[model samples]
Target: MSVALPACPSCQSEDVVKNGRTRHGKQNYKCRDCGRQFVENPQWRIISEETKGIIDRLLLEKLPLAGIARALQISELWLQQYVNQKYKLLEREVQVRPKPKSRLRVQMDELWSFVDHQGNKQWVWLALDAQTREIVGVHIGNRSAASAQALWQSMPPVYRQCAVIYSDFWSAYELVLPSKRHHAVGKETGKTSYIERFNCTLRQRISRLVRKTLSFSKKLDNHIGAIWLFIHHYNASLPANSSCPL
Candidate 1:
């Protein structure tokens, strides 16, 4: 019986031979040409595909990295590396998606996040698409009108032209908003309730978003990238219309 040995992973040669058995009794092989030793199923190989899947989901979904590692019995470090690599690659082309240009009754709100800069806590602003429950944009420093303006500028041309922007009594919205769009900022208008409610959803889903935590981000840049990807997938999962069914 010819024992099945894969081509040398190191040299890609079929002229391979059985070298020995591992401590775990898995068959090990040797490359006749390169003389490099390897196993049909390398120890690292066991987690490679699984690690890729975990990282893919982490990059594409809103799940916590630690949670994914725990569920897959994979190392958190492995997932983090893949997540970071993909994050960097996508960041360049990860401009805002082309959403519907039609006017939306969208609710916009900002949340304060704590990030470390020179050992001091800095604030991060968050803006979300309430209807799809997607994070539209994020900014660093004070959640002021300037910050809001920057966030709006970062949005795709489609989102920038929202018919009506629903926000709380934050003066920043007034200063940053254009005269054409209805930027209502009052309690009775319930302008910001949509995003406020979505905040609860985020708090429940991820410990990182929990307001109680003094540290809100593991890495500020990576966290923002992760949030952007999450919103992309989250919006994808939403119903086609993205709002109450007609």
Candidate 2:
């Protein structure tokens, strides 16, 4: 039997002509109807948006990379690469959204997790708006003044006009945050209770952040990506009134 011609993927037209062979030797075709060029044998497969939705949901559910692969019937390596690529897109999308000009009562804290293994500790710094229950900013690095500053700087300028700021007696918080706004309070006084509860929520939602769990992150990049994904989902899931910045 003779080989059949393929229609143009963009316009679904068979009015096509041979362009040339790609460097890899696949036959390239050009569509006369849509001016679209495509290879007869594409080197890259297009992943469907439905598959991407499943991946996003699974990620928010705190499934490990291997677990996600098993659920999707794809290789872990592919999922890993896809997540790395998609997360950068998500980060850029988040960065482009307009910042709301809302004064905030912010609570800041840090939680410890490990990358590579338990011996390699990493700190996840988080800032939350007490009124909105929205995670305003996140930073991950060593537990130091620099990391605290990074978290502080990530917040929008509008959020910096806080009525009060609460944190534990971490020296980094005292150094990085403005003295007038900062309150180093004990957990007993309930000053940091909201943030403490948020930390528990994070640990419950993200398996990698849980202590003594087998589903921990092996790479720091993946750790950050996972957290970013969770934060985005969590904020979106909140009620409209609850998520307002002010």
Candidate 3:
């Protein structure tokens, strides 16, 4: 009678020897041919659909990555990888309904935040539709005229051409927005109140955006992606009567 050993997972070689037991007491094998080590009948790790659903809900909350990991009983590394994957799949363009009405009112504002270090400042420029309270355009970058131009270009053509814009006395708005349609006003006047209020909503929901928080973003892409993810969810959750589908 002959005894057989399991093949190596990496090299698929049957020339394997029992090396030692894993910390969990699983039988571990080492392949002499490829120097590969693995266990037989290893239970492959899988993130269940139910677990993913929980993760999705958690991500929308103002929770830190480590906090979320601890709450879910999952490794932080796995949760980070999952979050990165979700960010990569996100669409860059904002999803918004088209409005045929001309002279729609728009409120614009910029939110201040930093990534990795406090010195590395990143500004989130936003445009909100006054009629439906939907975020219509967004740009993330330095507080400069170029970024303001990017925000202006991000909006649908209907807004760019016909909408009346209200913003704070930020010089960038004067440089980018159409002079005839743009109205730079003081916050006390409440012209840009909608966008300003939405900024508070973002900070409340996003941990990375919260001031003086330990849950800061390490990468700019992830930071932008997280904001976009929330914006998409926010837009989709709006009342059906509010959005005008194209």
Tell me the deviation in Å of residue 49 in model 2.
2.7
Candidate 2 backbone collisions, by pair: none
Backbone clashes counted, model 3: 0
Candidate 1: tens digits of C-alpha lDDT, residues 1-246: 977678998779999989889898988888999998888655463567755765676545345677777777777787688778776765522233357777665566666555543343434455656565555665655656788787666655666776466676677877886757746676566767767766665565545556665435668767566555655555555666565311
| Residue 171 accuracy (lDDT) in model 3 | 96
Per-residue accuracy of model 3 over 1-246 as CA lDDT, tens digit each: 877989887888888899999998998889999998888776546779999999988888899989998897888899999999999999988788778967799999999999999999999999999888889999999999999999999998889989999999899999989899999999899888878889998999999999989999999999998999899988888886663311
lDDT of each structure?
0.63, 0.80, 0.90
Question: Candidate 1 or 2, higher TM-score?
Answer: 2
Instruction: Answer with 2 or 3, whichever has the higher TM-score.
Output: 3
Residue 72 of model 1 has an lDDT of 74
Per-residue lDDT of candidate 2, residues 1-246 (tens digit)? 956679999999988888998888888999999999998656456668898888888888756788888777776777889888876666712231334665557888999999888889999898887777778778989998999999988886776765468899999999889899888989898877777888898898899998978998877777887888888777777666654431
Deviating ranges (above 4 Å) for candidate 1: 1-34, 38-43, 46-51, 58-67, 91-103, 116-141, 179-184, 213-216
Winner by lDDT: 3
Give the poorly placed runs of model 3, Cα more than 4 Å off. Answer: 1-44, 243-246
